[model samples]
Target: MLLSKAGVTAMLGLATLYTLLPLTWLLLSSTKSREDLFGTNGFALGGETHLAANLSHLFAADGGVYVRWLINTVLYAGVGALLASVFGVAAGYAFDKLTFPGKERLFSLVLLGVMVPGTAMAIPLYLLAAKAGLVNTFWGVFIPGLVFPFGVYLARVFSASYVPDEVLEAARMDGASEFRTFCRIAFPMIAPGFVTIFLFQFTQIWNSFFLPLVMLSDQDLYPVNLGLYVWYSSALTQGHPEDYLLAVVGSLVAVAPLIAVFLMLQRFWKSGMTAGAVK
Candidate 1:
């Protein structure tokens, strides 16, 4: 019993360390100067207290291009995630509850979309966007992101779990319109699922890079992820190695919002998962 317990504890400790190692490295590395990045112990602080300096440079660099990217990122992720969640939940609920001639076929088509990787469609999406004159614009990123297959899948599962037919029937018998029933009754019941969908879509849109890279050529429209990549690439090729520190700092700053968002909505995430499992 002692040996088994010790072995399990050892495995858990190793897993925890592995999970935390990259974040710890990033935090320590972001605080270091360019010179110290290579020379000093990776986990130790550097001699120069240049974190503030690096942030100022990151914000002010190229006429505050990073700020523009930050704004663009917020707009894309915020709007895209909102629309994705709303549409996903609405469609999922409709498919589950409402009868239609081709519902199954349409849902099968949606499932097929999930099987297709986003990367494979990048060039095609770019071509379509270019033809529609949306290339290099915020709409180019926003529109494509709103079409999330996985969000739809999550919504379908969530709707099936949280929404019951008897409750819907009760609302209908109370003379509630279909829209009213959904808005007042079904929505509240599925609130946790909506929040879960929102968070998932938010993370997906925020972390997306390849689609943005393919669609937008304008640096002013870049998201933080793409913006950081630009700086990293510039540092690699241009010999202005100090940009490295700025990139690291910017990366740390960029991730802060995602962490906060997850922490705030974790209850919904857990509840949604449990609801689905129990149902």
Candidate 2:
């Protein structure tokens, strides 16, 4: 028993170290200057202290393109996640509760969409957006991001678990319309589920690079991911090698919001997940 426990502890410790190693590297590397990056130890702080300098340079470079990208990312993630969660939960509730014609067939098609790779749809989406004069515009990214099939599926599962037909029927019996019942009763009951869906969709949209890459051409409209790719490519070729540090720092900045959001809403997230497990 002691040997088994010791072995498990060792394996868990190794796993934790493996997971944290890359983040540690990024943190230390972001603090280093170009000269220290190569000369100093990989894990140690560089002789020169220039984290503040690097951040200022990153903001100033290319007329503050990074700031624009940051704003665009927030817009895409925030608005898209809001729309996606609202629509997803509403559709899921309707699918679970309301009876209509061809509902199963339509849901089956949505499931098929879930099975399909998002990358495979990018070109077709781009073509459609071009025809609609949405390409290279904010709508190009926001519209596509709002259509999250996975979020819809999650909402359906959560609705089935969290929402009871009796409660809805009680609301209706109390002279509430369908929309009012959902707003007053069902919505509050499933608030945790809604937050879960929103966080999931927000992370997905924030990290997405391929669809934005195909949809928008203007650098001014690029999200942080695509903007970082631009700087990374330039740094790989002719630009200042120090730009690499900026890219790393920018990557950290881009990921900070997602982490903060998760931490803020983690309790709701856990409750939502566990709510359906037992009952």
Candidate 3:
């Protein structure tokens, strides 16, 4: 038993090291100047920290384009995730509670969407967006981001677990309209579920790369991830080591929102997952 415990502890230690080493390198690298970034060991700090200078360059580079990208990311991820969560939760609620024609078939389709990779759908979505004259526009990326099949799946499960049919029926019995009941009763009951879906979709849309790459042609519309990619790609060929530094600093900044969101909503996320597990 002692040997088994030691082995498991060792394995966990290795896993944690694997996960944090890259992030540790990124944090250390973000503080280094362009020369020291490439010169010093990745895990070591530079002789002089350049985080402030790197941040200034990052925001001021290319006529302050990185700021635009960051704003665009916030708009896309924030608005898109909120709308997607609402839509997903509503659809999940309908699936769990209300019955209509072809309901099972439609849910099967939603499940199929969960199985389909987002990259696979990106081309088709682009074609559709192009037909609608939305290509290269904010709506092009924003609209596609609102469709989160996994969130819908999670919502359905959460709805079934978190919300009770008895409570819904009582709401209806009390002369509440379907929409009213949902908004007042079911939604509150599923608040944790909503937070879970929101966080998941927010992270997904924030880190999204391919769909935007396909849909958007304008740099002004690029999200931070896409913007960093452009800078990093240019750096490799253009001999602009400063661009690499900007990319590294931008990466560290980009991770901040996800960390903040997870920290804020982690308790809700945990409760939502476990709340439905028991009777």
Candidate 4:
């Protein structure tokens, strides 16, 4: 099961290339003017540099609607991921620390939920949202995203490993209520786990397409991904290839914040992933 140094190095090199190749192409393509995009080599950066100009068109296009879509994406993914983390962590902690009837059966159901495909639920969810008169509203999409079964599973794994029984017992002996004990003592210990859940759900929600598409019909409620998709679809109808160019540029811009987030919060991994793996 051991690999030679050459084998390991070759594998690492291929993996790095596989991951970076698309990013490299996106960077090169984004630098081009509309004509240059098709005229030049796909991977080459030789083009009339118009990144700044493209961005200007991108923001000003369609009465500054892209900005609204950007805001919607931030609200949808950022808030939804954060709330998912909170609820998931709380549920996980409860599963680990609290005693109740049918707990194991309920958790087994949650695990089952993790195995269920989100697309399979889309039609049923749309039906329910329609019945509740929540369709095409912000809450319709936002509310559904807050449920993260995988995050709950991760949180439970983390809580069991991170939150020690002695600390909970000590908090109880000091007469702190269960909620207070969790908020004060247990939360800090599992904060890293919460961040892990947040990051995981953030990526999922940010990349979410099918759910948003099904729930929201209003252009104003569209997240960046769906909005860019609309522009891409209209690239030919508008008789301007730049709209297509803008979509590419917009995608490059859309992913930057997520990359920044990962860079900033990656340190939480040592505490969460390692502990979860052990447990």
lDDT of each: 0.85, 0.86, 0.90, 0.88
Off-target runs (Cα >4 Å) in candidate 1 are 1-15, 271-279
> What lDDT is obtained when candidate 2 is compared to the true structure?
0.86
Better model by TM-score, 2 or 4?
4
Q: For model 4, give the 10-residue run with minimal summed lDDT.
A: 270-279
Please write out the lDDT profile of model 4 over residues 1-279, one tens digit for every residue.
Answer: 356888999999999999999888888888888888888889978444487778888899899999999899899989999999999999999999999999999999999999998888888899999999999999888998899999889888878988889989998999999999999988877888888898988998889899888898899999999999888888878676778998998998898979988988887766655654664
Candidate 4 accuracy as TM-score: 0.93
lDDT value, residue 180 of candidate 3 = 95
lDDT of 1 by residue, 1-279 (tens): 999999999999999999788788888887777788878998997544577667778888889988888888888898889888888888888888889899999999889999998899899999999999999888888999889777777777767888899999998999999999888977767777788888988998899999999998888889999989988888899977877777888888888888998898998778766765676
Rate residue 270 of model 4 by lDDT: 67
Instruction: Give the range of the ten consecutive residues with the poorest summed lDDT in model 3.
Output: 270-279
Q: Is candidate 1 or candidate 3 better by lDDT?
A: 3
Cα TM-score per model: 0.92, 0.92, 0.95, 0.93
Residue-level error in angstroms, candidate 3, position 64: 1.1
Model 3: lDDT equals: 0.90
Q: In candidate 3, which residue pairs get closer than 3 Å at backbone N, Cα or C atoms, i.e. clash?
A: none
Q: How much does each candidate deviate from the true structure in C-alpha RMSD?
A: 2.3, 2.2, 1.7, 2.4
